[model samples]
Target: MTVYDFAKSVVYGVFKPLYRVEATGRENIPAEGGVLLCSNHIDNFDPILVGMMAPRPVYFMAKEELFKVPVLGKLVPHLNAFPVKRGMSDREALRKGLAILKEGKVLGLFPEGTRSKTGELGKGLAGAGFFALRTDAQIVPCAVIGPYKPFRKVRVVYGKPIDFTGLRQGKGSAEQATELIMSEIRKLMESSK
Candidate 1:
């Protein structure tokens, strides 16, 4: 097996039992091709939830500052976590993200841009929508509920895939379209919870 596959397997085997990871909607994930897995951010373990549940390796965008950590910087990319500046638009990150999709891999985006302390879902960035529009990638809305605590059941739910292309067809900027996309993400999340 590839190192990435082996690492993901080892991590999932260890934590899956420890955290009692219980996820449904695995069937909802597309069996082939590239797609965006948009989710609500709660705990630091959010990406782990995706990694364990998704059948394939999921690439996530972290902040640029994370890659600056001494040894950690060297490790994050190997783990399929790349950097993005939290507040501003980083064209390079977008380019990387697009390239990942173009290469036919799954990309993960936390619509909130950061962890949600309230445990309630937050508004998502337009980037989620824009990505779907730009790549014509199917958007999969995911909801992770409860258990920032230990030994508790962590429920990860996947909602239906959304095609936002028609919603923005020639009417607005990528920014405007993204806001609308995030709104749809919010709606999907709300319905699942």
Candidate 2:
């Protein structure tokens, strides 16, 4: 088995019993194509949670700092995670994300840019929109509800894909796209209630 598949198996073994994750709307994910999974960040485990639930192997744009850790730095890349410098435009990271999508892989993204300390959805960054617009990849709005607490049920909902077929790539278009993506996530969160 591949390292990613093995790692996911191990994580799902523990996650299913501990958190009891429930996922819905898996049908919304495209079977094969470049697609972006835009999710709201709630905890450090959010990426793993989403990846475990997704129908396809999901790659992520993690913060650069996480890659500096001796073990995680070496391991995350094998799991399809690349590092991005937080709070600034990391062109190289963006390029990598685009390349992943262009190659028809699933790319995971937390548009909020960071985990919300209070477990509330935060404003989304334009990076997700930027990639969608640039690559013409569909964006799947995902909402992960509930805190990362043991023995509690956490819900993950994937909404319909947002298409930016003809949208221009710029500050204004990116911001608008980000807002639309966040709005879809908000709807998914409400529906999960």
Candidate 3:
């Protein structure tokens, strides 16, 4: 089995029962083609939780520092993660994200660009919208709910793909697309509550 498959299997084996994690609407994610997964970030486990529940493997753009850590540096790459410099525009990161989508892989992104301190949804960065606008990838909005306290239930709700067909032709389409993406995530959050 691939490293990602083995790692995911191990993570699922551990976290699924430990955290009592549950997922819904996973089928909403397309099985093939490029996909942009936009979700609200809340905890350090958010990426792992979301990735584990996805129907397909997910590739994430993690902060550059994570890759500098000795163990995580070597491990994350095997798990389909790459580094992205936070703050300011990181063209190399953008290019990498675009390339992943072009290859028909699932690229995971946190719309807020960082975890929320209040556990509430925050304004989305334009990066997600930029990727959506630049590629024909399916933009799927997801909500990761509940606390990560041990033995606590954590719910992952994946919403339907956000339709950006006409929005792509408009001015500032990326921002508009990000808004819609966040809106759908908000709806999923409310539904879970």
Q: List the candidate numbers ranked by TM-score, top first.
A: 3, 2, 1
Model 1 C-alpha lDDT per residue in residues 72-96, reported as the tens digit of each score: 8987888888889878888988999
> Runs in model 3 with CA error above 4 Å?
none
The digit string of per-residue lDDT tens for model 2 on 1-193 reads 9999999999999998899899999999999999999998988888999999998999998889989999989998999899999989999999999999999999999999988988778998988778877776778999999877899998889999975654553434878888888998988988888
Worst 10 residues of 1 by lDDT: 180-189
Better of 2 and 3 by TM-score: 3
| Model 2 poorest ten-residue lDDT run | 163-172
What lDDT does candidate 2 reach at residue 84?
A: 93
Candidate 2 lDDT (Cα, whole model)? 0.88
lDDT-superior candidate, 1 or 3: 3
Better model by lDDT: candidate 2 vs candidate 3: 3
- C-alpha-based local distance difference test score of model 3: 0.93
Query: How many backbone collisions does model 1 have?
Result: 1
Q: After aligning candidate 3 to the native by TM-score, how far in Å is the CA of 28 from where it should be? A: 0.3
Of the candidates shown, which would achieve the greatest TM-score relative to the real structure?
A: 3
